[model samples]
Target: MSSTQEFIDEAAKIYKVLSNSTRLKILYYLRHQDSETDVKTMVNDLGLVQPIISKQLGILYRYQLVCRHKEGTRVYYVLDDPHVIEMIDDMLKHVKHEIKGEPHPRTLYDNKK
Candidate 1:
């Protein structure tokens, strides 16, 4: 088993990666995509600039949270991290609970033995 400090550090790292809304939206969009997409597609779909999308993608790629493929001069990205998907799902559930005035799963689970 890992130390508590190690777990804390890992959570902090994930939070850092997810702190940007652009990254979150990118991940959300990619989750439903059937094929790997390029920066231009993201820029067009998300209405964000190329540099912003590319920068967020770079961060995700650096953390190995996304898969990158190169075809000739173009690069494509796909959401590749199951843990990131779980985190996103959990966060969305928590937000839904908050909106519905219900207990969050995290809080309930944390209070359990």
Candidate 2:
């Protein structure tokens, strides 16, 4: 594969991380939050157990899609690039349009007036 194909292949790996519902929910929450959070915090905020969160986080970290920082004994994570947030925001817009008032659905609205 050429360099461009290699880059696309790497991007596909990143997509694999985002492909999981739990992982995407985790990223969506963390990215929108104003402050960074540690694994324990992620477990609590996501209502997921420590081990599952850790495993998902490991995948995200491996792809360099997440930023990790240590303060004291706890490690906090943030988005490696702000563009990830932008991407999520763009997708959320489409989701909102697709699910608007639909039964048994997820809905999001932007107050960008």
Q: Could you tell me the lDDT of residue 35 within candidate 1? A: 91
lDDT of 1 at 54: 90
TM-score of 1: 0.82
Q: TM-score of predicted model 2? A: 0.75
Q: Which residue runs of candidate 1 sit more than 4 Å off their true CA positions?
A: 1-4, 104-113
Clashes of each: 0, 0
CA lDDT of every candidate: 0.88, 0.80
Write candidate 2's Cα lDDT for 2-109 as tens digits: 999999998888777777988788788777788888988888878899898888888888877788888998889987777876887777777886779544334454
Clashing pairs in 1: none
Per-residue lDDT for 9-108 in model 1, tens only? 9889979999888899999899889999998888989999999999999999988889999989888999888678887898888889889998754556
TM-score versus the correct structure, for each prediction: 0.82, 0.75
Best by lDDT: 1
